[model samples]
Structure formats: C-alpha cells, structure tokens
Target: MSVTRTIPYLTIPSTSLKRGFYIGFDTDTLTTTNELGTQTIDAMAHQHHTSFLFNANELYVNEDPENGGRPPRVNENGRWVPPVYRDGFLPQAPGRMFRWNNGRIEYAGSNYQWFGGQGLTYPNNETLQHYSSTTLFWCNEFTQFQMMEADATTIDIATSDFPYNRWYPLTFRYERTLSRVSASVEEQYLAGRDGAWIAQLGLQAYRHRRNRPTEGLAGNLATIVALVAFSCTDDDTLYNVLINNLAWRGQLRVYDAEHGRRPERGVVSNIYLDPENPNGSTYDALRHLEWTDGPIIY
Candidate 1:
C-alpha cells in the first residue's frame, strides 16, 4: 500500500509567523526582516507602479524621438521591454479575501467575488467538490488544473507515481496533490536560473523606499507586502503564466467585472458548480457551498 501524506500550507496570523507567510497590517508601526529590505527588488514592480499612476494597464508607449524613435524602454523589436504583471492580490486578512477557513473555500472577498451584485438568487443546496487540492482545500480547481497543464501533470502529481513526461520530482508536496506555493513557486524561485534568489534584470527595490512607512500621506502606512514567491520571479514570467491561465479562466477575473482583478472565479465553474456539473461538480471531499454566477462580460 502507498502511504499518503498531508501538509498544512495556511499559517494563522500571529506574532510568531515565519517569513513564508505574510499577514497585512493596517497600522503604521511595522517590523520585519523581509520587508523588501536593503536587498534589490524586481524592476517589474517599479514599471507596474508607474503605470498604475498613469492609469495605464500596459507598459507599451509611443517611441521616444530622442532615441531615433526607439527608446531603451522599448525592446530591440519595438516591443515593451518587460511584459505586464497581471495577477490580482488576495489580502491576507480575516474575512477580507479568499481563504481556507475551517477546511472549506470561504468567499468573503465580496458578493461579487462569490455571486456578484443583488438580484441573483443563491443556488439551492449547492456544494462544490472540485477544489484544486483535496489536501489543501483553499486552492481553486481551475488554477491548479492550469498549473498541471503547464507542468504537464508531472509537478502536481505525487512522486511515488510515475509521470509520463521528463521532470524533476518535487521534494515538498502535500499528499498526491501539490501546493501552488511550495511545489511550483518554490521550485521556480530556487531554480538557480538568472533571476531565482538574486536579481537578474538589475531592478533593485528597497523596503524603506517603496513602503516609506514614515513618508507616505498617512504616516505609519502598513503597505500590503507581497506574500507569494512566484510573483517575485519576473513580471514577464508571471504574466506569461497568467496569460495562459486566462484561456481557461478569463471572465472569472475581477477587473473585467469590477476593476483591479486578482480573479474571483475565473473560468471557474462560472456558469455553475453543482453536483450535475460535468467538470467541476461536487465530490465526497467537498463541503456544502455552491456558486451560481452570470457570464462575466467586459
């Protein structure tokens, strides 16, 4: 018989939480060693921050005549030097964002995040089973399945089982299913490539500068520190993964329905997630919580 193992990825908010997890603080007083500190930050964040100020979602801009109609910002082929970072943020707070509470996918991000504005009645006796990982109930099935597709099902599947594709067996995993952060994110961060642990593109950021806890309008600003490692890799790489995932879960993005999207149900069982669903229907491992949504159109 094969032994199945399970590991918990969600760390409860507390004073003793490790660097692996980040909890948001609305207060001004903050203390941490990993607060973007003196170490360099990825240039992607700077580009994104600047674009956000200009109300532009893309980095593409008109060629500057100073450089013969091709500025350094524009690449050799006249393409935006760095791509976009399109993933949304899920504030790591209680009842504020998507979470795994008491072993179930709780949608408190908002009514829109779950069902959307009023007038749509809730599904009668709805419960969904297709969470990404049975061991880690918080994960969404669509993103997990997308990751599986990207990795060719070799990374998310268990090490004990044989994968048909050429791949590296993961040392950190939860049961047969994979943890998005530990399994894939960690592997990518530590890949020993140009951008893994060190800044490859030469975009260095300082915690003291970006956060400016003492400089911003509201003194003591507790900024939302990025918690996921996959994002720290490279904006282009992150956007690439996000773009691919969109084919499967595009409308589910919040920005299309709302603005500023991290994605709520993208390509989820968006139409519905009931026992009758052919793909993301209910299973024995799932709790009683069904989602009936309208087609999110731009």
Candidate 2:
C-alpha cells in the first residue's frame, strides 16, 4: 500500500522527528544484510520485522528552489516553487540527513549526484552494511531516485573478473521513476527520508576514491566505462519490484566514444582507465590531461 506524510524541513537546522517513523521492507525478496541501518537502504525486513522504528535527526531541506525545484512547471510557465525557509532552502534536498538513535546519529547518509545522466554514476546500495555508495544519473535534477535491489553485492572493482574498478562516490541506488509519490510532489520520503534511501550517500566514497584507493587505482581519469562505476557498495543493491536484479552493459548519457566526447558531468570514474592496459593516453582526446596514462577498460 502507498503511504504519505507531511514534508519535513522545519528549518535547515536539522530537526529531530517528533513522531518516530517506521522503516522496513515492503516485501521479503532482497537481501537486507548490508544496511539494516544506513541510508539508501533497500532490504527485506530482517527476521520478519517488516519495519524498524526510526527517529531521525539533522533532517533539513538542502535543495534550492531556484536551482531545481522538481517538476519545474506548475503549468508550463507558472513556476512551482517549493516552500522556502526564512534563510532560503527547499525541503526536497538529498544527501544531507543523519539517522538518529537515542539523541545521536545512528547512521550518517550522504551522496553525490549529477543533474543529467552523465559520468561515473551508478545505483544506490540498499544495505547499511556497506558504506560509501552512490547511484545512476537522471534526465534532469528534477527527477528523484530509489533503490532497486536492497541487497546487492558490492562490486569488487579490483577483482579480475569484474570489468571496472570500485572506487569512491559509489552508485548503489537504481535509477527509477517517481512511483512513491506524484511527480508533481517531488522527492519526498515520509519526514526525514526520501524514497528507499534516507539520503544521498556522503563523502565516505568521495574520500576513499579521491585519497587512498583501496582497489589500488590511485590516479583514475574520467572515461566512458567509469560512469556507472561510482557507488555505495554493499557490495551493492536497488529496482524492478520483483527484486529486479540488474547488471548493466551500457548507459544512457551524452558521451560518444566514437564521436569523441569529453567529461561534461563533474566526476571521474577511473584512474588510468585500465591500470594494466597500455593503450590508455588522455592527451590524445581526454579531458584531463594529467591522467593520460594507462589503457581503456572498455
């Protein structure tokens, strides 16, 4: 059954949930193993408990009304504005929430996103066991996302069998439609949440990828293959109601390798493209020349 609640955002000050809410699996299909707690959590109710009592703190609206208020049109040119605070912020922000328990953060959820379907992006991981996950791109900043598989194995980018390197800014949530609410309502998650994720994943993935790469990929540059590799791994999980398990072969973005495109989105997915492949050289047509070493993973 579909559920609805009042939109939170008393202010950007991170208010607490006066009336604690419930977060649990709607069904018993996906793996609830990773994140029984962290945001972007997609999983079945652990041990037959369909929902968990949650009290969220640090919940605020970080999205901007002028920048992208979702649906972008009250009717062509009427301008549908989100309720702004005294300080000027919207209630539909992503990646800026903290899960509270007993007056402290039980989980901290954050993530990086691109407005249009673009570089180094992937789905949100549905579990809390894994940290530093992200998800795929949207047609515009107006569209919100949801986790497809709640419990997806974190992709071991280091493994030889796997195609890409697993780095920071992980994409774990699946790209999806606005099914939870009307597209007109925008990205609303009961009061302290948005869709399957509590919030867009934070800097854990960014810090890992930008600093010390666990997969040994120290200096990755942007590449076509790296787009969907960013994620919060569970190893990972999100969509398709029947546990719509997915492993993508290609992406839908505005880059064409044969046509020669450059990084338009603000992320880079690979260091050296392929650490082992010798054909990688960016200066030939690569956007960032500093990373013009290594071979293409594709």
Candidate 3:
C-alpha cells in the first residue's frame, strides 16, 4: 500500500499562536554551515519578523507623460516588479493588500512621484486635487480569469497549478477573504534585481505626503496580488482605455452567450474528491476568499 503523507499545513498567520507547530528547516550550506537541522525559534521574532522575509508580491504601473493628462492620473503600461519590503506600518502590521496609483516623472533621484496637491512648482494645489486621488477596483472573477487569456501573445501555462498565461500574473490575493469595502494602501518602494534594489515606483492614496500614517486612513484590510513578475514581451506601443475598461471578459462572455445558449448551471456530479474533506470546500473557500471573483474593469 502506498502511504499518502499528510502534512498538517498551517495558514500564514497561524505560526505565532501559543499552541502550534513552530518549526522550519534551513537546508542552505551557506559559506560553511550544517545542511540539516530542525530549528525551533521564538514566537514574536520568528512569526512577526523573519518569516516575512521570503514572501513576495508584485507591483505594476501605468505612467503618463510628464505633461497634461486626466485629473487624478492615468493608468498605463510600465511593467511588473515584485517582493516589496515591509514598511513595518499598518498594512504589514495587520497583513493585507494595498494599491497606490501615481505619476512617473524624471524627478530628483527618483523616476516616480506621487502627485499630491502642492505648488505648481512643488505645492501646486489645483493639480493636486485633480490628479491626486486613487481609485480602487473590485477584483472579480472576470479579472482573475482574464489573466489567463493571451493578450496579444500566446498563453504559457508553465506551472500547471497557478493560472498564469503570459509572463505577468495580475491578480490580487488575500490570505483571508475581504469584504466589499475593505481596503489598504501603501507607498511602493523598490524591487531587488541584478545586484542592487533600484527605486522604480512610489504609491500614494487620496491624501498625499502629510506624514499621515498610511495605515488606518484606508482601514486595516489586506490587499493581495498587487503585482506580478514582469517579463519583456514585445513592443513599447500602448493601448489607451478611451471610454470603458471592460476588455476581454465582457466581450468573450457576450459572444459565448449569444452563439451558444449554454445551460444555466453547469453540472459536475461525477467530480471526485476525498470524502474526508468532502467537496472542494476548503480549496474553493480559500479561492473565493482570497482571489478576486472576476475581471476588474480598471
């Protein structure tokens, strides 16, 4: 009989609890260290600080030219980057997701800047009110599935587990499910690549740099799938969303509904799953909770 090993997996937030398995293995030979050893560390240090080091998230941007544009800002093509450092602030404190949209300019020592109403030179308030606000889009099923479609390129399903087509996987995921209005915002710092972590982008919310803690102004709710690993695809040519943000999801659904009058509820009674767990309850629950239900029209 082939014995199926059942490893009791704990959620990310569970390691720090008083009564639970607090164990890990470091198989790195380093410069000169033991290859195998079971390490039991402290609750606060291991759970709150160190374990977060390896976790990663991506950030993508849409930059507008350094001149006249829409009020708040315009979302455009910059590319994706990942593994942001925890600022030890609100979102990271409570552990959630946050997205901040801003302007990209060749500024002093930094390429990106969050346009808060300062002067026309620096404290320009008019431009600030107009182009300083951030908009949040609900990540629905439409957006999640759309990540798989070939956007002018063929879909490459390399992992065969997580659904990512093109090199970039643009979906926000939460360790826990989020209610409709829950939100968090953070200023994106930099990405570590090559040898040095370069300053590429920064993020801001409805309010600009007033020293207000970005933590609570937007609640403690977490944000997920903020950015994906960016890989070079084809051209510098960009597509502008003139009117609607509805791209592939709506169009494809409409096409399928019209041509093929499919049944209302699809059937899968023969689907096999361990009766011990019964149904894809746990898995579906996580996906329904963490992943956005459909396509976000932003």
Candidate 4:
C-alpha cells in the first residue's frame, strides 16, 4: 500500500528580512539496535531534514496604477522608464519582470531593457544577465538545486516506501535568522575576535530500508545519511560554502511480528572551499570528528 501527504503551505514570514523555511522528518518511533543488542530511539534517530534560505529583498513587484501604484513604463516614443524601486534598491537588473494581470501575478517581461538599452550593468560596467526566466537565478541557484538533487531530497522520501510503509506527518516551519546575522558578527568571527567562525548551522539526516528481507536472512539492511550545511543567507554564495555528510549502512534483524533488531555503521565526507574552512584548511573542524565500529561480526 502507498500513501501521500502534502504539508499545508507554510508562508515564509514577510516581516523577516531574510526569509527562510525548514522541512524535517521524525523517525523517533522507528526502532534500531546498537552493539549491545538493545533497542533505542531518539528524535535525531533516522531523521531527515532540510532548510532553505532566500533573500526576500530580491523579490520585486511591478508598478501598475490600475492595480495599486504607478510603475515605470515605456512611452509611445520608445523611451524606457524604470519601475519604482523597492526599499530604495532597484529590482535586480537583466532578470524577468513579474506583473499583476487581472488580480493574478504572472511573468510579464524578460531581459529587462534599461534606458541605456544594454540592460543593467554592475559597478565594474559588466552586463548583468539573468539566465532563468521561469525561476529566480541569484546566488548559485543551479548549485543549490544540484545539491538537493544529489541527496535524499524531501520529495524523494515523502514518496518512498521507507518508514515502514506507514503514513507520517511532515512539518514545515519558517524562520528569519538567515538574514538577521549582523555584518559585525561576521567580521568579528572572521577576524578571530570570536572563538568560532560559524555564522549559522543546519543539519539533516536520511535513512532508507528495503521492504522485504533477502533469502536466508532474518531481516533487511537500511542505509542512512546525514548532512550538516554551513553559512547563512548573509554569506555570498559566489564565494564560500561547506557541506559535511555522514553515511551509514545498518542491518534490521526482524525476529518476528513484533520484535526486530537494528545495527548501523557509517562514514563521513565533506565539500567546501579553501577559504570557507574555519580550521584554516580546506576541511572544517567538524570533518575531523568520527565514530566507527572496529569489525563486523557475522
């Protein structure tokens, strides 16, 4: 049997300068066994979660007097007038412009043409281009999408047969911490005024178990993976970022209808830029931490 559930739409708080949200899985009820042959469960046990942070300031609205306000528009003479700046900052240039049509927001234009006809240019006079029209493409969108795709994404587990083929409630929550970290705090940390270089931290874990046991075996094996991603929305995505991951393979010894056994073993890997390392190397200090079982007994 298969079941599906959609978490109600969670609104990222508009009041938050740095809008963000989190999706997490709870597997505390799932049973597991340690080397001692005892069963145990914890909130972090067999859990999977992910947090997403986006710059709300990047979102812009068009000016339409018919809708609410007058926006900059092109005149009959073919001269371009810029739209009203949001929060005193002009909408990101060379990107798709969204507008309201009959009370519905929709894509209006792409590859904005500024008064200069060359689109918007940066301080260095280089042209700013937005490659995606349907999706916003600021701050390594492709990389973020790729990372999510490579991992056990939220969508993947929600649709999978893991968690004992039973239904479980998914939770979504919003937070503003991603944009709230002050620049002074970052400077202090990077300058070594603070003991730690971590500005913000997020953790996620994933686990997968086969439905049926192999022939001649009492039970099946489960695969688990966890990730720790660092940096907040305040950090520049073009520069530095780090992700630490731990993977584990475990055995599920099901004795009968009600009793089962679980034992796990795992490894860790990391990805980061040289400058992003808090330990003054390409690897973060967390990467050095490890736990392992000496040898497997049959």
Alpha-carbon deviation at 188 in model 1, angstroms = 6.5
CA error at residue 50 for candidate 4, angstroms: 3.8
Q: Give the per-residue lDDT digits (tens) of candidate 3, residues 66-89.
A: 432112221243222211111111
TM-score of decoy 4: 0.17
Candidate with the larger lDDT of 1 and 3: 1
Cα deviation at 81, candidate 1, in Å, is: 31
TM-score of each: 0.17, 0.16, 0.16, 0.17
lDDT values for all models: 0.21, 0.22, 0.19, 0.20
Ranking of all candidate structures by their lDDT, best first: 2, 1, 4, 3
Per-residue error for 72 in candidate 3, Å, reads 21
2 against 3, candidate with superior lDDT: 2
Candidate 4, residues 1-298, lDDT tens digits: the string is: 1111113453234244232322322233333334456453444433322111111112233455565544554435544322222221223322222221111222223332222322332344544332111111111211110111111211233345543222111111111111111111121111111111111111111111223211111000000111111122211220122111101011212111210111110111111112211222212221221111110101
| Local accuracy of candidate 2 as per-residue lDDT tens digits, 1-298 | 1122212332222124233332223332332223344333323242221111111111122244566432232324443322112222232112212221211212222321222121122255222211122212211223222111110122322342422332222222111221111111232222122221211222121222222112111111222222322222211221111012222211122221121111111221212121111122223323222133221111
Model 1, residue pairs in steric clash: 28-220, 41-204, 41-205, 88-262, 126-290, 249-267, 252-266
- Best candidate according to lDDT: 2
* Candidate 3 RMSD to the correct structure: 23.8
Which residue pairs show collisions in model 4? 63-71
For model 4, the superposed segments whose C-alpha errors exceed 4 Å read 1-28, 31-44, 53-87, 93-181, 184-189, 192-298
